[model samples]
Target: ATASLASQGTANIWSCASCHGDKGEGTQTVPRLAGLAPAYLAKQLHDFSKGTRISDSMAYVAKSLSETQITELANYYGAMSSPSGAQPALKGDLARGEKLALSGDYSKNVPACFTCHGTSGIGVGAQFPGLAAQQPAYIAHQLAMWAGGARHNSPLGLMAGIGKALSDEDRRAVADYLASL
Candidate 1:
C-alpha cells in the first residue's frame, strides 16, 4: 500500500488525515479532501499517477498508488458530505455563468454544461465529482492548469478537450457558478 494508506484499519502511521486532518480540514499548504466530487477526485488521482496532473510530491505518490487504493480513497472522500451552503457574498458575473451552465451560446458553439456536469454541476457517476460549492480559487487554478495541459484527469476523460474549448472567461464564469451552487 502507498504511504497514504499505511494506517489502513488502524490508527497508526500516516493516513490522509495526518496532513489533511480528520473530516478533511486541511492545514496550510495541504488541501481539504472530504466532500470533493468523486469524479474530480478520481481524475486528480489518475492524472497524478499518470503524470498528467501533478504536484511536487503528489505526482509520484499518486502514480505509486494501486488502482484499488485510488478508488478507495476517492469513494471515501466523496462519500463524506461537503460543507453545506453557499458563501457569504456574490460576485461580478454570476448571471453570465448561469446562462452558460443552463444554456450555452449557439454562436459560440459551446455545449450546455449540465449534460456532462449534471444539472447543478454537482456531477454524477463513478467518475464525476460534485462541484456544487468548491472553492473558487481552487477551481480557477484547475481550469488554468487544464488549459495549459498540466491537468488532464477527468471523469469522462474529456476535460482536456473541454478545457481547450473554454476561454479564460468561460472557465471563470462556470467556476463561479459552481462556487455559487
Candidate 2:
C-alpha cells in the first residue's frame, strides 16, 4: 500500500518518485530517502507538517499524510538500500572538507562532523541521519537553513549553532567531501 502511494500519488499529492528517484536516490537538493533511519524520516515529516522545517513542497506533502501514512512511508524508504554515488558540483576543497570532517577547527567553535555523525558520516543514530552519498546541494542547503534559523528541529539546537559557526566555504567543503564518500 505504501509502495503504491510512493509510486502513484493521490489526486491531491505528487508522486514521491517525481523528485526523489524511483529507488529513492533523490536528485540534487531533493534528498535521498533510501536506507535512512525510520525514526529520523518520521521526525522530518512531522517537522515539515508542523512548519518547523521550511520546505514548501515537503510541508504540503507532509501535511497531507496521516500519521499511519507517515510511518509507512518512513519504514518503506528506510528498508530500501541503494549505492551511494553523488557527484560533487560544488567545487569545494576536498582536503579542507576531510580535515573538517575528522578534526574541526576549534577556533571556529565547530565540532567535528564525525563527532555526532559517526566516523564516516554514516550517522550515529535516529538523531543524525547518514550523510554518506547525500546530495551536496542538499547538505549545503540544510546548513544554510540551520544557520539562518529556518530549520531548528535539531537536538539542543546543536546543528543551528554549528551551522552558524561554519563559513560558507566550510559548509561547501564538508558537503562535497561527505557526498564523495
Candidate 3:
C-alpha cells in the first residue's frame, strides 16, 4: 500500500504521493486524503473511474487501477492520521466567509455549507467531505468546477447549485475561511 501510495512503479503512471504528498498530507490544489472516510475515498475513486467526477489526471489514474486496488488505497489513506494547523493561502473576508458557512444568504436561497459538511466542516460520515484545513485553491477550483458543470459527483446537485449561486468573491472568501479552520 505504501509503495502504491508513494510511487506508480512505472513511468507511464503517476503516484498518489506525487500529488497528495508522501503522508497524504496534500499540497496546494490537492486534497488531504489522510483520515478521510474509507467509503468516501473509495466512492471518489469509483466516481473518477466512471466519469461522474471529472478530472483528467484522476480519471486516467483511476482507470489504470482495478477496483480492489482502489479499495486498498482508500483504506490505506483512511487509516492514516491527519496533520493539523493547515494555513490559508488566499486573502478574503473571513467574517463574511464565516457568515456564509454558518448562515447562508436568505436572499440567495443558499443553505449553509455546514448544513451538510458538519458543524466544524470536518465532514459527515462518508457522504460529505471535511472542508476544514483543505487547500484554498483546491476548494475554490472545485467550486468553479461544480459551477461550470465540469464536476458533478455531489449528491443531488448540492455543490453545483451552491457553487453557481456564490459569486467569485464569496467563493474565495469561503475557501480562505475554511482553510483557516
Candidate 4:
C-alpha cells in the first residue's frame, strides 16, 4: 500500500516519486527523503499541512493526505537507504564551510551544523534531520526562508536565529560543504 502510494498516488495527489525521485534520492532544490528519520518526515508533512512550513507544492500534497497516509509515506521514505545524488552547485569557500561545520565561530554565535545534526551531518534524531548530501540550492533556500521568517517551525526559533546570523556567503559555503559530505 505504501509503495503504491509513493509510486502511483491517489487520484487527487501526485506520486511522491514525481518530484522527490525514485528511491527518494531527490533532485536539485527537492529534499532527499531516503533514510530520514520517520518522525521528522511526518512532522514536516504535518507542518506543511498546517502552513507552519511554507511550500505551496508540499502544502497542497500534504493537505491531501490523511494521517494514515502520512505515516505510511513517511515510513516508506524513511526506510529507504539510497545514496545521495547531490552535487555542489554553489561556488563558496569549502574551507570556511568545513570550519563552520566542525567548529562554529563563537564570535558570530552561529552553532556548528553537526552540533545538532550529528557528526558528519548524519542527523541525531527526529528533531535534527541529516544535512549531509542535501541539495545545496535547497539548503540555501531553506536558510533564506528561516532567516526571512517565511519558515518558522523550528524548535525555539533556533534555526531562525542561526539563519539570520549567516551571511549569504556563509549560507552558500555551509550548503556546499554539507552537500559534499
Task: Return the TM-score for each candidate structure.
Answer: 0.72, 0.98, 0.93, 0.98
Q: Give the per-residue lDDT of model 2 (tens digit) for 41-62.
A: 9999999988789899999999
> How do the residues 9-105 of candidate 4 rate in per-residue lDDT, one tens digit apiece?
8789999999998889888889999999999999999999888899999999999999999998888899999587887789979999999899988
What TM-score would you give candidate 3 relative to the actual structure?
A: 0.93
Candidate 2 residue 121 Cα shift, in angstroms, is 0.8
Q: C-alpha displacement of 128 in model 2, angstroms?
A: 1.2
- Model 1, residue pairs in steric clash: 37-129, 37-130, 39-127, 39-128, 39-129, 49-63
- What is the Cα-based TM-score of model 2? 0.98
Is candidate 1 or 2 superior in TM-score? 2
Question: Could you tell me which residue pairs clash in candidate 4?
Answer: none
Instruction: Give the alpha carbon lDDT tens digit for every residue of 85-137 in model 3.
Output: 46767777889889999998878878999999999898999999888888788
Per-residue lDDT for 146 in model 1?
A: 72
Q: What is the lDDT of residue 24 in candidate 1?
A: 64
Better of 1 and 3 by TM-score: 3
Better of 3 and 4 by TM-score: 4
Q: What is the lDDT of residue 163 in candidate 2?
A: 92
Q: Count the backbone clashes (under 3 Å) in each candidate.
A: 6, 0, 0, 0
* Tens digits of lDDT, candidate 1, 101-162: 78976666677777777778777765565556665556656767777877766545566666
Supply the global lDDT for candidate 2. 0.91
| Superior by TM-score: candidate 2 or candidate 3 | 2
**Over the full model, what C-alpha lDDT does candidate 3 score relative to the true structure?**
0.85
Worst 10-residue lDDT window for candidate 3 reads: 1-10
